[model samples]
Target: MIAAISENDIKKLKEDLKQKGYKLTPQRRAIVDTIIAGKGSHLTAEEIYDEVKKLCPEIGLATVYRTIILLEEIGLIYKLELNDGCSRYELANKDEVHRHHHLVCNKCGSVIEVQDDLLENLETEIEKKYNFKIKDHSVKFFGLCSECRKDG
Candidate 1:
């Protein structure tokens, strides 16, 4: 599971938003709290809205969508696009320069997070060859999970 969000992290996020001329309103806070609580789930906007509605019953789906977009815009979250036709999101880890890779099970539609940075050597070689300043990268591998293989 991903690291749990801390109160300090939330405070820092609020300050970051303030610096960016945005405020963390009540609805946004509920959405963010839901995202924090759902770590490693890679929740979609609809799922976030559903959870946020439990807290802010008057919350609208459009607000969730807008908050998600703003968070992505501010680099507070990362939107992961897989073949499932749903845009999933996870909190950005400030300590990690590169986003962790993901293993997507094609059969069961389950995501297994790959915590290893398996592309370092390849990234180094590419940077050396192309003289590119590599910052970060994302990778997703799709295949059947162990259970799916067993069932198949």
Candidate 2:
């Protein structure tokens, strides 16, 4: 599950945007608020657009796409490829903690979040042996979830 973004975090993000020579427009703020509100949902672009439309009726799909791209560029959000064809997005961890992995149910297409950092030792080993710095990583385990296993 995704973590919630506090109001202070939002204020900090707006300040960061201004410092980076970007304007926090109403549409962009609405988009960010929507994403923050739907923390655990891993919303897609279309889903975000649909929700943002409710807040700003004049907002367009292209604007949502551009805003998402900008957010990802600014390291405020993560674009995830969960192997379900559509790209999903979640807020970036503000504390620089390791990101949670995902358990994707192949049968039902449900995504379950795994909060542990399972690759700490592996990352250390790789860095020590190969002298390759690991900036970030993601893992996805594919299998049947409890309900899907029962059904199968």
Quick one: best lDDT, which candidate? 1
User: In candidate 1, what are the lDDT values of residues 1-152, reduced to their tens digit?
Assistant: 22356889779889989998989898888877788788789999999888889899998898899899999888888899988899999988787879999999998999998888889999999999999989989999999999999998
**Whole-model lDDT for model 1 versus the true structure?**
0.88
lDDT of 2 by residue, 14-120 (tens): 88788878888989988888888887789999999999999899999999999999899888899988788898899887765667799999998888988789899
- Where does model 2 exceed 4 Å of error? 1-7
Span of 10 residues, lowest total lDDT, candidate 2: 1-10
Worst 10 residues of 1 by lDDT: 1-10
- State the lDDT at 87 in candidate 2: 89
